[model samples]
Target chain A: MDRIQQIYNDEKLLKKLQEDQNLTIEDVLENEMVINMGPQHPATHGVLRLVLRLDGETVVGIVPELGYLHRGYEKMAENMSHIEFIPHTDRLDYTGTMCNNVGYVLAVEKLAGIEAPKRAQYIRMIVSELSRIAAHMVAIGTFAMDVGAVTMVMWTFREREKVNSIFDRIAGARFTTSYTRIGGVASDIDDQAFAEIKQFLAELEPALVEMDKLLLSNRIFIQRLEGIGILPKEDAIALGVTGPNLRASGVEYDVRRAKPYLFYNEIDFKIPTFSQGDCLARYFQRGDEVRESIKILYQCLDKIPQGEVIANNPKKVLSHKTEIYSKMEELIHDFMIINFGINPPIGDTYLSVENPKGELGFYIVSNGSGQPWKLKIHSPSFCNLQAVSQLCKGAMVSDVVAIIGSLDPVMGEADK
Target chain B: MNTKELIVEKIKEKFGESVEEVSDFRDDLCITIKKDQIVNLGKYLKEDPDLQFIMCKDVTAIDWATRKKRFTTVYHIYSFKLNYALRLKSNIDDNPPTIETVSFVWQSANWYERETWDMYGIKFINHPDLRRMYMPEGFEYHPLRKDFPVLGIPGSLPLPFKAE
Candidate 1:
């Protein structure tokens, strides 16, 4: 007790505290308090640390400190071959691994000037939409859980598990399904896989409707969320926030619709936009997107053609394992490819797909080499997370959690 | 004329000599302009009515370890009005590469510029908050630079202080 009193009464310690905070101890205790919310917090979803400056319960300022999950993926991409990096991409936005895989392979394909066959394109579209639905489930569930609705998480995860099982049947892995290959998928979607997907899709609608009634229709949920943490349309665009968050702000600019990659031009689906730019609108925007994704998936199933899954680009696409084992020429080709890697022409190209979270793009600069000279990933979560400070300026401390939840930033992608 | 051709012509007309090289690779338009002209070009691209490149999609740097101008800063800007995206590249020849910040032009450039700086160590002049984006503040080496080894330098990333 004497030692504690001595330290508290020390002039040097008091002076240092005053200097560091630019305020006396009394002032800090009376008015402003700085609190570190994360690096590990349940509401933050991952290792995102938010240092919140609070005056009573109201947040004066919030600075989001990232990089706790920094894996240096771009540096790793430079070190490995194009095919060798596909699995690495699965770890980017773990919720939407399929979307990341497709985004990456599309970039590599665009650089090499090789197109996946029509069937493969439709398959890619199907898998990407499925991945979108699964990702949004986690987003909507975890977001509801963040805003004090825990039951929605169980319902959403149940649906997500069904999607995972479908993936397991198709890709042989549930979570980190590195199913996408360079010029095509690992294998064709067999009859059993199609049957499972169709069954899951049928089961999904009723489950989603029930979940909606339990959460979205509840009076408490509506009152808690409606106008909390509003980001205007102008700010949304200026900050480069994409995906459903940007759509909720009334931007209507979807990469699939605007850019039209892999025959998305032929597909008829609405880009759901909500004028309100609030937390509730962002949540509803994702719900609407799931409907659109279902529509796209149905269209894909109907319009999928019967042909070769992989493109016949001898230099670019990998050969079948059976052919590699049996044929001497195929063995030599596989050997050369494994050793030297597929050499893209001397050029660079940036191709982005409309991922579930936002636009996941890969900018590849190839110096006519087996591996990329430089690979830059433009992750949408990293951009969307930037708007949190602006949104949470004068809101209550709890609203900060809601705003971060609304952004749905996966730290793996954000810090990559 | 198409949007790409229109953009290229306008860019050429506005700042002809500053536009170092213009190339269309894989249907994407890339314009390599002088480093000093980045700010002016960014402003023109954003504010111009027809070429309202409102969103700065990404900012990254490419390190050519042996090149005279060792680093090239790249910006991918998108326009909703035009329904097209353009790539802007500029070479930095300084001892420690320095370039102007385009955050004032497009607000999205703020984080992207910070990330580029964190990864490549190219300084963005007049950036609002030019702190490290992904790496720890105490960490010295830029991981993305070609010269920086893949297996990082030992003892560079300091661990948390232990309570004695």
Candidate 2:
């Protein structure tokens, strides 16, 4: 009590505190504090823990601790057959299961030297693009909610549910839709599902316009996000940041344009890029990407040719269920495939897809066997999360959530 | 010459003997070079005006359990300038395999190298802060190693302490 009274009575010390209202971080280093942000915190979006060292309210250093949800997917892939791994890919990025399905199947097809039929390729493109739109919706919605705009989540999720219903109609499962196969898709889309997709696309644009009016131009939202967490272009590329985050930092590279897997080369769309490299820029980039994905989806729907959905490679690709039950040849083939997996040739190939999060890749090494010798998943979230420490340093503690939301990391893929 | 031939020729010209194997599979270039030349090659690939392999996409290892060289460390580096990705592999013959770290070259490699070390039990020389990525600090076994079982060894992973 005496010490407190003395300090309170000390005019010089009190004067110094009052005058130096804008104290630099170095001035408060003597009272350095350490805080653990999460392994269970909601702002992290999943099981990600960040150990932050703080000098007053300024974050001096941050170390991200991960792998709370690691199920050893790589080890599991080695044990299972290539065909058996499709369902597992759905769990990698739960928000964009179709994209993960497409990525894994394409990798397997590339490794086995199997070409997907033209119709199947078009189907793959449509579903993956729709999945991309769904993922960006989640990203933008949660991002706005994180920054204190609550209504945007409702608007974004409404559109997402429409996309989910479309998925349910075509893929049978709304969430974990293992819709793609090694040489083709699981099933074909019917006329009703196609009509539903067309209607959803028409509704999405007006809803986006409403969302833009509500959140994008609002003064408080812009002020909260505009210049927060700026990741420069050079640093973004050097740190392996990809997808919307890299594009927001002014990198024009996209896996669809760069590699041209499937019929993406034939499709016309723009890769949205912004030079600001801030939280607002990242948010705007997602909005632009959703628009581009919509464009691609419309083109796919228009140009889709009517043909066989699954490729005719019975040796590598699985036969339809009806054929397996009715035809003797398909039954024998199904039996053989179920017991012994499709054996890819002895070689290694790495195939990446432009997943909404980033470059989701499968590096498969086949030793002329049903099971892969080694499988490495090059997940983009794992790479993007690495740059968090660099971004958060010297920034206010409150902006950490904003930075994480802008990155839009799915912990399933990161922890996988 | 095409991009593939040009890249091979440039790499071979710079380091002749170090370039051990160069092959094309699925239109991708896979180069196996001596472990000693990895850092040098990485620097050259990134710094050269023509080949700006600025992005390090992945760093992983293939565990060949019974081979003479127990592990093969692989790197997939990309050059936006060339619009190509090149795969580089180097063999580590030691038990508890030890190899040079390229995290210094690519900032993104820091976490990837940590992950590689955690999964394969491969020691990366000169790594900044080497620690297990997924498992706890006291966990003994490397889960991704070939000898490690799918279901995991019984009594290996420690369970949480329960109150009486």
On TM-score, the leading prediction is 1
Question: What DockQ number belongs to candidate 2?
Answer: 0.87
Q: Which stretches of candidate 2 lie over 4 Å from their true place?
A: A1-29
lDDT, each prediction:
0.91, 0.93
User: lDDT at A387 for candidate 2?
Assistant: 88
**Per-residue lDDT of candidate 1, residues B49-130 (tens digit):** 9899999999999999899999999999999999999999999999878999999999999999999899989999999999
Strongest candidate by DockQ: 1
lDDT of 1 at A156: 95
lDDT at residue A247 of model 1 (Cα atoms): 94
TM-score of each: 0.96, 0.95
Lowest summed lDDT across 10 adjacent residues in model 1 chain A is found at A21-30
Q: Pick the candidate with the highest lDDT.
A: 2
Which parts of model 1 have CA positions greater than 4 angstroms off?
A: A1-6, A9-30, B160-164
